[model samples]
Target: MTTSRSTYHHGELRQAVLAAALDVIAADGPGALSLRDLARRAGVSHAAPAHHFKDRTGLLTAIAAQGYDLLAAGLAGAPGLRERGVRYVRFAVEHPAHFQVMFQPDLLRADDPDLLAAKERASAELRTGVAGLTDVPDARTAGIAAWSLAHGFATLLLTRNVGGAIGDDDPEEYFRSLTGLLFSPQLDPHGGE
Candidate 1:
């Protein structure tokens, strides 16, 4: 896969390595990730990715950090809670590799400062969206429920588990309808059903 003899000599080696790693994860899942394979895919020596990431967990941490940053951006300025949830699902669908790595804390260096910061940023964005529910006494619970709904739906869609159940309906459209149900007073835990 060597396109140029001096490929790694360029300053973009880290980006190339990250891109290659994403391709590998998309093709074979994160468990198959290896710095050696990434280096090969990036047309560089085996040590190239290692120099950049140090180890597999380190690389996964970087990917997770990037995912959270993207998620925060996607959730930013959403008009309401439902829109923010939709954005979360859209982000997951559009960036499966990053999404996969981001949630599985066990697969990443959870102690990494950059990863922690990114995670906090994403969490704050979600909290902001949930805070829009003025009637909800506990914003934390609402935030978790919102996150669960979006994350579960995104996982189902990505795995094709929804199949033809949604027919020709856009996933986002279906999610919007579902959000109405979720926020309805009848389903409220403290509303006595």
Candidate 2:
């Protein structure tokens, strides 16, 4: 007799499939995802993952949504913009698979409700990091700059594109120093040095 333990319920199967997919992404990349492969890894029917996620985009959407939530959580406790930037880099390094998919809008269902909510939550947290920066004329532009700096550094580190130019220095340390340089006592918007 087939016991319930041998058969995962809907929610269980979904979670299992998501985990397996993330493993595949971490090992390979998001482009390597295959529902059949994920199903095999999860020990579920080939159709199981498809049923839950609908398609590759669906699965990636779910992952992107989850990534935003994780990023938001990581940034939530950060006390300042620099700390939040550090947290962002850490999150990308720790969750490479999620980070890879989170920014690839073409690979996800951008209109998915969960993804929208998650993205907003992350954006809000990011804004909070720069909210007190009166040195920047526009909070939105400063927030974007902070996010861009962190994201660029993280992506470069992940791809090893720095080409050993930063040899002997930890990427996190390098990033912190760079942020410090950029965020150091700001110039007056009125052309004061």
Candidate 3:
């Protein structure tokens, strides 16, 4: 069994401890997480993290919240929906620890205020962009299509389904190029569906 190294007090200990939890999840599976492990990572005593997280579930919840916040931030200031899609995948790739927690609903409170707010912000941006770019008229439908495209690609990358790293001017470039034709703003140039 792992042990703790530090004992952070109240105050910012919650966020700091949560950050440490993410590092653990990133390194190992969620089962590897424990208050003592987080404490050790944070250089605190065994029980230090528990005061802040109460339990492993609490810690995971906080990590998911942070993940959503990071996701929302990445989506913002994007040059366009294309850039945002790339950024979203990049965020998941770069923060696999956070991404893992964010998607595992059984482990965290994805419905928390912070999580909900961040989710809404990300979804709203995607919806708005798709609405402006698609003839689908219905914002939800267009948004779903746009999200499904990039999200499927990202999921593939996450699961290592693509195999091997994407090269310079690689296949991903081919897909990015397709966004123009596949997700065009023009209203059914090929004729209505």
Candidate 4:
């Protein structure tokens, strides 16, 4: 049987290390992450991760950048603001490790070029979704509100704070209903009571 210490080809090392890092984050949280541990998990020498990531912060920056790109992709082409919000929540639930690392700026290089670009891409996608809210008096504030609802709900779910309350309920469907309450005609600025 191949051992955990089995060597990977050069081209595979970076991705192998990243996958190991994600697994570590998922199982033990980011605080438990270490390049040496990831190297061991990826079956590489302890110094292998540094060849690709430079250091722990560099590794986290890569993860954060990747997370934002994934978030942007998930949000892209959504039909409307509500759908985009649902997609956002889905992304967080589906990629909990990435979601966990993506928001912790203290653990990342906030000025990393790839991270900044990916973040902007995700933001632009959300802005596009908000722009479709023609009935809202202020799209910017509306966008923030929509994002807050989705992010907060996802955070609650991830933390298990809402598990019992939402037991057996389809999270996406529940989120859709919540969005409906917020975006109902009664709340539309241009709609008459």
Candidate 5:
């Protein structure tokens, strides 16, 4: 059941609107998001969203920042680069709306302090994951390669580009296997040359 507008306390309205925005983005993409539509979905007045987000960019910026913080947390708990890559894919799959907004610089406030800090935290986590691999000749290049592979796979999965090929297999498990192929010997810290 949906909460009525009258029932939302001061701060709850902001969360409610954000949740509603996520639903809209998940269902219809970020291009379909509108402050007025979010207000309607949240059962609030048209001006309600403006009170919190100020504008559409402001709302998307909030989502992007939240996404980065979530990504950082997910990566932090994983043991190694492979697991971190899997966690990154898992995050993108689970939070498609946030994932969509987080990478679209045109949809966000590039200079927003919160967004910048959150992005850096997530990047640091990725770098730390790559740094764990002692065999890598260049940590920076390795990190980029890992991120590209993971992000590309996640994007393909999200877009259903590989659905027919993946069939009923769990994407995460499939991803884990694929990573194994790439990381088996050369990238594995414990493996012999």
Candidate 6:
């Protein structure tokens, strides 16, 4: 009497495997993922994923790549760099598994070409988004500043630092307002003093 909960057909096992890996990572973080656990989640045999992923690192690399694609898309749709920062936080919250694996490079196959490509794509999009809103002359400085501000804001929001500053008055809105100061056009030469 096997009561199967999954309806995934055989042909879609690869995607099913990835969805299961993300499920595992979201629940337990990247370090806690195992092929056995992923298989269970995917409703496949324990050894099934080896044919697709080779190892746990391979699976994690795929998850991180997916994360980068998602992050690139999220930032691209933002109204401005400030809102892009907010969207960054939103993406992390919505894709906790991808965020966890992408940030913890040591946990995944950082050397994988696919993962590297995705990382570059996401990084470039983030930098391009910042450039679109700022007149920062040097590419490196703009990159550093944009990354630090967005990453720092995302880290703070993800860790619940918002409640301490805003006293629980809809923390997300408060966070958006604070980071808006970071990207204000008033910092420009003619926009403000």
TM-score of 2: 0.88
**Best to worst by TM-score, what's the order?**
5, 4, 1, 2, 6, 3
> Taking the tens digit of each residue's C-alpha lDDT, what string does model 6 give over 44-114?
78888887889988888888898998998887755555566667777877887788788887777868898
User: What lDDT does candidate 2 reach at residue 181?
Assistant: 76
Residue 150 of model 6, lDDT score: 62
Best candidate per lDDT, number?
A: 5
- Per-candidate clashes come to 0, 0, 9, 0, 0, 0
Q: Tens digits of per-residue lDDT for model 1 on 1-193?
A: 5445464566788887788788888778899999987777777778878787899999999999999999999988886778887888899879999988898979988789999999999989988777667776787887888889999999998888995899889888788778777676423223211
Lowest lDDT block of 10, candidate 2 = 184-193
RMSD of each: 4.3, 5.0, 5.0, 3.6, 2.5, 3.8
For model 4, where is the 10-residue window of minimal lDDT? 184-193
When 5 and 6 are scored with TM-score, the better candidate is 5
lDDT of 3 by residue, 62-166 (tens): 777777778888877665567666677778778788888777888876567766776677666665455445445676776677678777777777677775655
Query: Candidate 2 lDDT, tens digit per residue, 36-151?
Result: 88877777677878998999899999999999999999989676777788889999989999999999899999899999999999989988777756766788888888889999
lDDT: the better of candidates 1 and 4: 4
Lowest lDDT sum, 10 consecutive residues, model 3, at: 184-193
The estimated TM-scores of all candidates read 0.91, 0.88, 0.77, 0.91, 0.93, 0.82
In model 5, where do residues sit more than 4 Å from their true spots?
Answer: 184-193
How well does candidate 2 score on lDDT at residue 168?
80
Better of 1 and 3 by lDDT: 1
Q: Residue 98 deviation, candidate 1, in Å?
A: 0.5
State model 2's lDDT.
0.83
TM-score of predicted model 5? 0.93
